[model samples]
Target: MCNNQLTITNPRYLKYARITGNPVHVYSGRDDYRLRVPCGHCDDCLKRRQQQWFSRAHHLMKRMALRPDQCLFCTFTLKPSVYEQAKEKPYIPIRQFLDRLRKHPRFREKDPITKRYRYRKVKFPYLFVVEFADGKTAAKRGRVSTHRMHYHAILFGCPLYWWQVRDLWQGDVVDEAKGWYTGMGKAEVDPLESESGVRYVLKYMTKDCAAHQYISDVDARKNGKLIVSHGFGRLSKEDIKIMRKNMLRGASSWFCHFINNYRYSIPRYWKTACFSPNEIRCRNDSLIPGILRDFVKKRYPFPDFTFQQQQQIYNCLLWP
Candidate 1:
């Protein structure tokens, strides 16, 4: 596996993790700490990993025309997971997150509310299957078992929506949500597997995911700028909340309201304020400078709330 930021081929999707020389994570699945390899790696790269990768979702991952006795990896025999040996990760209760997601204006599940009148789907799906390398390199090069089911539907007035299925074995309880119309191809070029079919095959191979922690400290002004550059003028409250909680650097409660709500068609918001950041070195073309200019152009187009309101808005340490 190339540890120097190389790709044998670009990943089919935008977000597969890199294969590495270092063992970076811990999982109950593996007896040892392993380097996480993405499913997109070439056969040569994966062969180097010496792993027995399997998935219960799309059988294609294991459907090569090989003898049953043929070794799965380096002549090692395939030992299918029995209920006895497989260690199931604790299930994440989806109720709360699902509830929160449903409340979003964008929430659209394929049910009666959506089936009759919903017209279209999202331009982009939010569900992602992030792969990471698994196992030691010098000692034992390895590939991550890959697959995570992604869902899409336009059945409701909510219209476009997507979600990911992290565990398929739990489907006995989630059969409704697990609904799928398989056999459709994802790409025109594939025979037994079209792009969608290949994607369907890949959805079953999820390696244990621990990468969510890595996203906990994402830069906001930088992230937000990317969104703005894409031409979106406003942000959701959740975005502002993520900003204020320090997940985003330099997030202020006041700025949160203006940045998250005020649309960009109005240029008076940050047209002339200080474009430079005092703390985190904001990213390139960070519209923050432009935004500050807009704010300045509007004479700091901000609220001058009553003292009581101000006190309630800002924490004591931030009282200004």
Candidate 2:
């Protein structure tokens, strides 16, 4: 587990609390002040990111009205020599390859009637993850152990044949005897048969690679240029808002606060007001102040508070 919990001690939160007449009670134990910051390198942070990506991709698939048959799972790789040349900065070649592939004549063809080159009418929304695999496992299968970097992608509204993609990726180097292009590298495409395929491709977003063999895969993601798309653009602001709203509904305050303000230190107000380790000793409803009760009721109306839970409600509103 990542022991990178950041402590929240911002004075602004204290000022806000004082201004609101809810002066935060400073806890004596230092452990109570800890905040879980979502550092991207940690497993927990990566898992959350994976879930977020899955949600966004699933929502995008539905928004595009695409069926499983309309989607294709594709893989693209570079030649061993090419990988060796750019091993330290793998994202450079990956970006260059994707850019060239997108601008290839097959993907963007000139209209016969207008003689104008235009992208295809169908929407092409894609999500891809660049993966680096040190092929030590290949030894069991009688294969050489080598470093392999490749892309796993889920492309929507694809209309081309597998060989067409190969030809495009390999720069049309045709092997006349083999009836297919044997060019620089490999390209494999298969129909996405079910919803599970979406999860399958997105799974690579959190896939871990051995740190000893090469650089961390997370470093490649930090470059933020591996994405390739044609007709469909990125998710709109409204779409993201809707997805976040849906995800945060009925969620805990700690989780909601962390996600809403990721990579930042948690506010002192959240630590003091939203969560506590001490058990409530007072349970009398009449003991709660009318103003505090109304505020808590207005903010959280879903849960039916029982006699035993009244103390918890009061603690959340006016932390002791």
Candidate 3:
């Protein structure tokens, strides 16, 4: 009988042939596959990563039985102060604002009726996705144009109003504030009760990479740039390290075995063929008893032959 090598083709064989490789097909279900392939953090790769994160978020929310109204969807935009407008990098203040929102969301308010002091805070268990723009695109006639950097976040277990949420970032500053009160930069909050809102918040995630406007361009060390958050589907630094450890790199023997085990489950879109070697090497075949070899061939005569023929036929089809 033919050995395991005759099953699916190795990725190196296709790479050496200089053929355009298909996306890495990760089977998620009986007929569902996720296309995940690295592309130097380009538009396509960034988009795939966003989709992966969104899927994780969706699943986590579903698993937690979170109702749409239980979550608060909001956008926090940075306003240009007189001091911030003249700076070369206006995103610095924006980053500082986000840091304050994530870490220290405490603010003080005095009750007009009772003349009592009250301090409140918006703490963790939140999800925020950030996007940046120069506002040259959103500007209209008679409208002021300025640098725009903001975040689209989902707050869990907090029912703060739009204005109250705005105050958390733009309130009295003798205490501490991250934003301005001119309403130039607004915080729009809405109740997320449907799947459409989730999609809307995540839709523009990878568009920055497409336009080459990475948050890293503003500040290389800034956190909460791409997809950052706490609670629910939050992937921490340690989680990322574990994931990286489990990730398979380039093609290897284990990869071939993986392909073989899932041969029947492989999606048709996945390219699976080998190319002829430039310098073929001869090796002795393994010794098998004549009776056993005949029995094996009789039982599995077509197992390996079909895949070998498939590779040969595909190569022929590629030739002009």
Candidate 4:
């Protein structure tokens, strides 16, 4: 079972907890008080990780100012023979291939000062989730059928056309047996048409099967990386502070409750509410009323009300 609560001992984090309602703890720490490392199979931990990833992706999209047209959803697969060679550590070769592809001359321009090739203006922030599929045909043949590894990625600021990307991905491998050129198994590239498309790409990180497969790999399991990313750069202390503020502003009441109760010692208020018969509501119920009314009034300016009537309406809505 996953330990849902953690004890706060660090002075820095304790201070943070006092100021903000958040309980901060070191993830995967080996200390006696800290919870055991996540197994990646526990439902509670999995859900928490999914939410963390969603928030991270949301933050990255906003920070980069990425538009739908600037993003591409891409899938990359490896040939059966290639996978067979590195079955134990498939991600190693795939990571190497991605590094090479990113540095390909097609996406580079010569610097006027140094006359050296440099990547184009596009920063090319990208996220990749590795997934596996079973080969039914190979299983039927009585051969040891291993899981085939592939990647689904959300790429930003990639200027290449789908076909062009496909061609570049195929590379210049010549298949002697077939008497023609071949590349990797297959590649698919499609433009993101809307924000939903980005979410669709991020959804792969939450799939139970995908998580299981990634955890099955010895290297990836040891590292505990559910997804691979590049070019976004590191987050500084200031950036983290800003992100936390943004998260609090946009978070739902349930999320706030979770954050506030994340410690081993549950607060008295939540404990009382938990035992109460009546359904518990958010502490500050009035927080959303004004925003909701303004949105409703702006979208559907229904039967206009006078000052006195508006006051009555507000009173009725705010009634406990």
Candidate 5:
């Protein structure tokens, strides 16, 4: 089994909740929601963390580790609803800026393609904040580069990485196209359609619980379900079924769904740091794709890989 536990040994985790009637309200950041007993949220919060629950318990614990939610891939913040609404209402960010553009004598669209594109009305549609059920969205990131995951690509759109690389934010995607990145990982995107007529790509990051990264479609008429990656490590199909069943039972809000969605991606990133004696063996053995394997060579110390390992990397990047 993979070790997906979050640490919470500090009494600090307990403080995350405020006791209320039968349902405990597990609170984090500025949000609160209902949960049942064994209330892992509560247990991790109050009970001294048992050497785990560290990251899950409190962002403060990391001291050095910035909150994962702050990262672009985790894009827990940013409201696409607001931005879209402003566009719909003709509410420009600055009246003067709009006026200047409007006054230009030849203001009509010149490009036939641009003019052919008709606009649609989207209320409270900031751009993309994962389509909240309640119509509420989080604050947008101050800068495009710093936008969190959901907010990152929402403003642009989720490519779902039809390519070999993954980008945390829309701003970063351009750079990726130009061959600039820390490293690239690929995975097939499974679109989990929700009742709300929306679809989300769920996957766990290397060091985070599941996070909602992409929303493929949305229809206001239906409720939505989260789309998560297929499997992780060596779990048998039965194990995955059991875990999914348990996860659904304990799930409370969209947050739980986020974890449920990407639960598989987390452990797969864990490597022993060294699996071969000689450098060539190690480089050839890495899970990175042959296309990307060149990366390990001049990019970083080569990690070993075999033909089978190369195929495995390809399978992951090309996941559905």
Candidate 6:
């Protein structure tokens, strides 16, 4: 006889996968239109974390009052060719393009108004942010497959023409015959709209959240990388990296805090039930029996909630 009580204390854990009739405790949470099993490493959890960073970044842009009318939104893509198609990690060229953009005189120039005199040049120190999204398109018959490494970038500074931006990326190359020079591929530029439009631009980057895809795709890890920024209150490369690390650490701490303050009580029907650690592993399907599932469903309408809500409910002695 299993004498272990199954109790749920953490709201972060949405559901338990049922592997046996060992009487496991499970919680149901709504993610989008369907119920999701939320583990710390699940795709939904990762997407939520990434969205937090995106929201923070958006807030920072608003605080700075970055005018989108003066900004440029550009998409940089790698060209399709025999040599380009042969590469495994296609995003390597995208990284090189970003490095070149960082070192480019046009990008590094910070003189706000250097063109005042005849001997001066126009200076535009601005913020440059880029997000990576999968461009992996399926190849039809007689077509070659490529990773389609690309980036969507927002340049919060002087306006630039489409051809000018393309040429600048092209100028990064020294050898035209090696095909490395042609990797600049296609570059598209357009004048940015309002703040809401900026969000729309970033929307594509967060579309499909596939944990396995992220691990295998070369472009996935570059989603939040800051390409270049030269102006007042600019973050250096190291600072950006540190800030990202801190953000992830902060998320982990939130879960830990919740876990520390969590207290679980056994229900009346399962007064003697307790779960062993070795038997608490994830499995498919529901661990809750039909009767208990109906009982819990009638009591708690939703199982998913934030840590703060969990703390509030605990303080109020609310459990279902």
On lDDT, the leading prediction is: 2
Local distance difference test values of all predictions, in order: 0.26, 0.57, 0.48, 0.56, 0.27, 0.45
- After superposition, the stretches of candidate 1 with alpha carbons farther than 4 Å from their true spots are 1-125, 130-276, 281-320
Cα lDDT tens digits, model 1, 1-320, are: 33332322223211222343323332224322233344533443333221121111112222322222221110001112321121121112122223333444444445576465332333211111222212233234345432211222111111222222211112223234544222111111112222233233233232222222222232111110100012112324553344345323432322322322431111212211212344324432354455444444354334655545544444321221
Candidate 2 residue spans exceeding 4 A from truth: 1-3, 7-36, 98-123, 172-182, 209-320
Cα error, candidate 1, residue 31 (Å): 44
Question: Lowest-lDDT window of 10 residues in candidate 5?
Answer: 200-209
Which regions of candidate 6 fall more than 4 Å away from where they truly are? Answer: 1-43, 80-145, 158-162, 171-183, 204-208, 211-320
Task: Give lDDT tens digits, candidate 4, residues 1-320.
Answer: 35543444555455666788765553225343342344555566655555555455554666678777777777877776676554566467556656666676787898999999788654456777665544555678888655556777777666666666666656665875662436666678888787676666655554553335533555344222344565243455566455345434642532232322341222233334333322223433535676556654664455675656665666654541
- Count of backbone clashes, every candidate in sequence: 36, 0, 1, 0, 59, 4
Candidate 2's clash total is 0
Give each model a TM-score.
0.17, 0.55, 0.46, 0.53, 0.17, 0.41
For candidate 2, the C-alpha RMSD (Å) to the true structure equals 11.4
**TM-score, cand. 6 vs. native:** 0.41
What is the lDDT for 205 in model 1? 30
Query: Over the stretch 1-320, how does candidate 2's per-residue lDDT look in tens digits?
Result: 24454555555556756888864555324433434444555566555556555555555677778888778778877765566654566556655655655665666878899999886644356776766665667777889855566777777776666556556666565565553444446778777888688777766666452233254455444322235454233456575455345433532322232332443222332233333433111221323366576666676564676645765876754653
Where is model 4 poorest over a 10-residue stretch in terms of lDDT? Answer: 259-268
What TM-score, to 2 decimals, does candidate 3 have? 0.46
Q: In candidate 5, what are the lDDT values of residues 7-81, reduced to their tens digit?
A: 333333344333332222234332213222232222222222211221121212132233322222223222343
Query: What's the true lDDT of residue 182 in model 5?
Result: 29
Q: For candidate 1, what is the lDDT?
A: 0.26
C-alpha root-mean-square deviation, each candidate: 23.3, 11.4, 15.6, 13.3, 22.7, 15.9
Error of 5 at 278 (Å): 49
Rank by lDDT, descending?
A: 2, 4, 3, 6, 5, 1
Please tell me which model should have the higher TM-score, number 1 or number 3: 3
